[model samples]
Every structure is written in C-alpha cells, then in structure tokens.
Target: MTDTTTTAPAHGVTISEAAADKVHRLLVQEGRDDLRLRVAVQPGGCSGLIYQLYFDERVLDGDAVVEFPAADGATVEVVVDRMSVPYLDDSKIDFEDSIEKQGFTIDNPNAQGSCACGDSFS
Candidate 1:
C-alpha cells in the first residue's frame, strides 16, 4: 500500500485551529456554504489603520484565498484583498475564549505600534 502525506497550506496569513473551528461553527449556524472570512485593512482608526473582518458571499478581483480544515471535517476559507496583502503577510489569526478577552485577534509582525484603544495598528 502507498502512504499519503498532508501538508498545511502556505498562505500569506494563517488561522489557528481554534479560529478555524469557531469559523466553522459560525458558518454552520448561518446555513451557508458560500461564505468566506474576509480580512481587510482600511485607513481610519486611532493608529491610522483598522481591521475589518466579516463573512463575504462575493469574490472580488485580486483576492487571495486560503482554506483551513476544521475539527468537524469541514473547511473554512479566508480571503484577503490584494491591497491588504502586504500589511497582513505572515500574520496569524487566533480566537480567544477567556474571561479577560473573548474575540478574534490578529498577531501581525508588521505592526510597529498600536493605539491606546488597541483597535488599530501602524
């Protein structure tokens, strides 16, 4: 018999297993399979940049996509617009479910500093 090996996808950004699982659950609740987690950076925040995360049903031009496997054998897709690629490259997305914080966080190596509110980065 032949053996098969699986490798993680090489994406500009990566989502943690926890994040993927959460996304999968959200999608399941939404009852849609055409949705993708879209991440974008826009100019307008305490640090002059803000992050936008949402579920998208449409695909625009120059979009980069990466698929992650969920614990339930479902697949979660993440899409990054071309304009935000440079700022988000090599970044990691994780979900936190603790008393202190309960939300999605982005660990961006390119961010030099953030504002006092911790909502934006430079």
Candidate 2:
C-alpha cells in the first residue's frame, strides 16, 4: 500500500496502468530493485526518431522520473532523458499482450508521421 501514483512534470510522457503492471512484473523477474525503466528517443529508423526502452540503474543528470504503484506492491519508476522530453511530450507508454502482437507501444501525439515498420516516428 504505497502511494498510488507519482507523476513527472506536466509536459512529460505518461505510463498507462497496464504498462506499469507489465514493467513491475519484469522488474520482479529480473530480481533487481535498483533499476528504473528508461525511455528515450533516438536518431535512427526509417522515420526521424525511434523509441528506446530499457532498464537502467544510473540516474544521469537532467532525467525526468515518474513512479507508478503496481498491484504487486512494487513501485515502478519510469525515466526519460532531457533531450527526449520535447518529442515525447504528452505521449503514453502502453503494453499489449495479444496473439498477433505483444510488446510495449508508444502513443505520441507529437508524432507527425510514423514509419510503416512501426519502429520510428517523426
């Protein structure tokens, strides 16, 4: 029974409840309590930018953080670097576990267009 939600700055991206739950389970499976989910926009892919998501232990300077409380009583921290803030503003991270596709997805209102491969956006 920890705080239900801890959000980042107003302009920052958000994590959906399902995404938080999935992240919590993954973190538990990894057995590492020190890691945070890092989300970043990188320069690659068919479109102008690509999204990167991974577990990181380092809290680099200028990183924005948001915390979500999971059903398993774990607090999952999601981080985004300073450079990515603008591109990801008001975006959302979600998890899908369907038979056709299963993984984390981003819904970015800022994206003007996305690649057909679904790996990058401008």
Candidate 3:
C-alpha cells in the first residue's frame, strides 16, 4: 500500500487524508468548530501502552500540534501531549470504512508488538 502519512520531522504524529476527512465530519456533526483531535498514549492496556484518541478543546502545556487541510477547505488540527510524543512519534492516523470495520486506525512504527484486539502496543 502507498504511504498516506505526511510526517513532519518536527511533529510527533501525522494524519491521513481519510482520517482528516472523517475527523472533520465528526466535528461538524458535533457542532464543535473549536475542538481538536487529541491523541495520547496512556499506561495500561493488554500489551503495555494504549492509544487514546478524543476531541479536546483545551491545549495543554507542551502539546504538539499539526494541521491538515481538509477537502472542505477547512483545517483540522491534531494535538498530542508532550508525554505521548515519544510513543506516537512517526505514527499515522487513518480512517477506514470497510464492511468489516469502520473507524480510525493508528499505524505506530514505535510499537514492537500489539495486542490481539489491536488496541494496545508494547
């Protein structure tokens, strides 16, 4: 498969166009124009580390931000907390809508192994 990630060396994470489009639609559905997609790594999963993805309005201290231009002419901002940076570095967030699954997926190069459910990484 072709690489859809647009990784900026200065930034910790990247978002695919499909992911950006999905996020934009969700934001619009929630009527939250001021919110951003916050990605973080939290301790505790079947593996070792778990990924956390949510909509956040507050920009915490030392948060790394990256902007992606959506097909709708609007920009989507993705934020990652300082602590999660190392775990998510060079990671790509993608969206898939196949008959089997329909959701956001993370491609993390830093992960050595992941759980059977694919929710946690070691």
Candidate 4:
C-alpha cells in the first residue's frame, strides 16, 4: 500500500508516502549522503523521451530538486531538471517485488506510452 498522509506541494506533482519510504530504505542501504535519485528527461526512449534514474552526489548549479521527506523526517531528494518537472508532475516513485518486475518504478502521470522493455518512454 502507498503512503497517503503526506501533503502535496502547491505544485501539481506529489510523491506517495510509500514511495518515499522505499527511496529512504535504498539511501540507507547505499550508505551515501551525497547520493540521490536523479530523474531526468533524455532525448531517446521507446517513445520520444526517456526518464533517467540514477545516483548523483552533486547538485548542479541550477538543477531543480524534488525531495520526499521520510516518515522519520529525513529527506531523500529526487533531482530532475525544470523541463522534466512538467512531464513528471504528480508522478510517484514506487518499489515493487514480483515475478516479472523487481525494482523501483516511475508512476508517471504524463507518460502515455512506454517502450516494450519498459526502459524508455514518450
């Protein structure tokens, strides 16, 4: 189940509490303070654009950041450029374990279609 208690920012985008917890768990396991999940929009994917998910230790000079405050009040930041923010607005990052899929997934509201392998998106 997703965490539903956290308040959304004035902006339309919001992250579920469950997603925040999952990110926090990963951050704790990684044992890195400088690392955060960097979500970005790239030129190619199955669709016209793709979402990049990775680790970053440094915040660029003018990068936009979306931070999900952990249940314990610690914050796990999700950095995405301003351009990508609109496409990913109200999107949530979730963790799942199943026979077919096991990892963090982007629950993006703006993605109309995804690649066959689910690596890229439009």
- What is each predicted model's overall lDDT from 0 to 1? 0.84, 0.84, 0.85, 0.70
> Which pairs, if any, clash in model 4?
3-18, 13-90
Per-residue lDDT of candidate 3, residues 1-122 (tens digit): 11213446345688889999999999999998999999999988999889999999988777777788776798788988778888888899999999999999999999999999999999
Top candidate by lDDT: 3
lDDT of 3 at 110: 95
Every model's Cα RMSD, please?
Answer: 5.0, 3.5, 5.3, 5.3
Better of 3 and 4 by TM-score: 3
- Which window of 10 residues has the lowest lDDT sum in candidate 3? 1-10
Compose the digit string of candidate 2's lDDT tens values, residues 1-122: 12215554433777888998999888788888899888999999999899999999987877877787776676788888889989999899999999999999999999999999898999
- Model 2 regions more than 4 Å off: 1-11
After superposing candidate 3, which stretches have Cα over 4 Å from the reference? 1-9
Tell me which residue pairs clash in candidate 3. none
Q: Model 1 over residues 85-119: C-alpha lDDT tens digits?
A: 89998999999999999999999999999998777
The weakest ten consecutive residues by lDDT in model 2 span 1-10
Q: Using lDDT as the measure, name the better of candidate 1 and candidate 4.
A: 1
For residues 71-92, write the lDDT of model 4, one tens digit per residue.
6888777676667778888776
